[model samples]
Target: MKLDKVNWENYYDKIKGRSPRPLLRAALELEKETSRPNGRFAIDLGCGDGTDTLFLLENGWQVLAIDAEPVALERLLAQVPTDLTKNLQTEVAQFEQLTLPPAQLIHASLSLPFCHPDSFPSLWQKIEASLVENGRFAGNLFGVNDSWAVNAHMNFHTKQSVEALFANFAIDYFDEEDKPGRSTAGSKHWHIFTIIARKMSDSSN
Candidate 1:
């Protein structure tokens, strides 16, 4: 789908007041086991409506919230508590145009699938390069069998391909679901891979 065709403002309003994705909450829970500082930085790729972004800030994380839609950034910035403003940064940029900074955590939620198939490899490579040692990546990828897989603009993966994407990371959390579901876009069959993986050292930390 053309980025301009998306009704981002309306989409954000539709999901307003909802909690952050469980995948993000799980990633944060895993962080508690480590000795990382609460003030460590995280990146929220394709952060919509600021739910995950606000959660990160509330927990003392410094966050760089990025989304392609200007309205997305505007809504996110507007909802940020005044005191937490210093903890947050907003960027308006697309997946293909992004150059991520190294971070302790990167959360994308239900966003990466929108990346064009041809650009996904390079974007994924950039994601890997942007993580600090032992950092975590939490997000969902649409599966090949998803109803939306027929859309030529979106990227969908089979299990083997998804596993290959995380070959260098330790799979901390992984769930595959194929079922009927509702999205902001409308009702659809959802075949998705929910993942949270930690970057591993050579010794496999």
Candidate 2:
């Protein structure tokens, strides 16, 4: 079966009021376990309508919320409270064009798979390099068995590839989901890997 083409603008509208993704929540919880200060920087990749970005700001983090869509940033800024205005910054950029900065946390939810296959490796490398020692990375990756795997523009991975990507990190949370689901794009089967892991401060950890 052919996967329905995504209309991203409408998809953003459909999820406007949704909570932050579980991977992000897990990352936050793990970060708290470190007893670290709350003022660290975080990058919210493909931040869409900025729910995760806002969550970061609310918890005293300085946030850089990046998305390729201007409308998405506009909607996010519109919803931000007046007091939080200072803690948030936004960039309009695609994953392929991403140049991340050193950060304590980097999050992308339901976004990375949309990156073109040709650019995914470099993008992943950038993510790995930009994270500070012990910095956390949280996100979802589409598995090879996903219904959307046939879409040539999107990237999908085998479990081995996903595990390889986090080899240097101590994985904190991982849940593989393969099931039927409905999305704003359409009805489909989902094969997803939800991950939250921290960069190893020393290779030993």
Candidate 3:
């Protein structure tokens, strides 16, 4: 699936009122356990309609929500609470062109797989570089078994490759799911890896 701006805008319209992703919720809960400082920063890449962004803001995290579609950003701004609006910053840009700032948490949710295959490696590098030590990354990555894996425009990874990508991170949550499911767009047979990993603070390299 080539996810152009039009498709993302339509997707935002369809899933506007959806709840935040469970993976994100789990990551937040983990952060709470550490009694971490409030107002930590987060980057929500491809933050369509800002479901996750809104949740982060409500919980006191400053968020930089980036999406390629203007409509997505508009819808997100409309849905966010006025009080939390000050904590939110939005950028209209694609993942391939992303330049992320250092953050305590990086939440991509269901977005990263939409990146073009050729651009995914560079984008992944940026994601890794943008994270602070001990910072967490919470998101889904499409598996090779996904129905959309055949699409050259979409990035899909095998289990081995996914593991290799996070070799420098200490994985806190990793689940591989290959089952029939429907997307917000009404697509079926979803294969995904739900991941929440913290960068290894002790890594020397």
Q: Which candidate is the best by lDDT?
A: 1
- Model 2 segments more than 4 A misplaced: 1-5, 35-39, 202-205
Task: Provide the clash count, candidate 1.
Answer: 0
Q: Looking at model 2, report the run of 10 residues with the lowest lDDT sum.
A: 1-10
Q: How accurate is candidate 3 locally (lDDT)?
A: 0.86
Q: Once model 3 is optimally superposed onto the true structure by TM-score, how far is the C-alpha of residue 63 displaced, in angstroms?
A: 0.5
Q: How many backbone clashes does candidate 3 have?
A: 0
Kindly list the per-residue Cα lDDT of model 2 for residues 4-116, writing each as its tens digit.
56667887889879997777777887787775453489999989888888888888888999998988899889888999989889999999998888888899998999999
Cα lDDT of model 1 by residue, 151-186, tens digit = 888899999999999999999999999999887788
lDDT of each: 0.88, 0.86, 0.86
Better of 2 and 3 by TM-score: 2
In Å, residue 12's CA in model 3 sits off its true spot by: 1.9
Candidate 3 residue 145 C-alpha distance from true site, Å:
1.0
lDDT per residue (tens digit) for residues 1-205 in model 3: 3334446666776875789889899999998874445348999998888888889999989999999888778888988888889899999999989898888899998889989999999999888988888889999999988987767888999999999999999999999999988876566677899999998863522
* Candidate 2 residue-pair clash tally: 0
Q: What is the C-alpha RMSD of each candidate to the true structure, in Å?
A: 2.6, 2.4, 2.1
Give the runs in model 1 whose Cα sits over 4 Å from its true position: 1-4, 37-39, 202-205
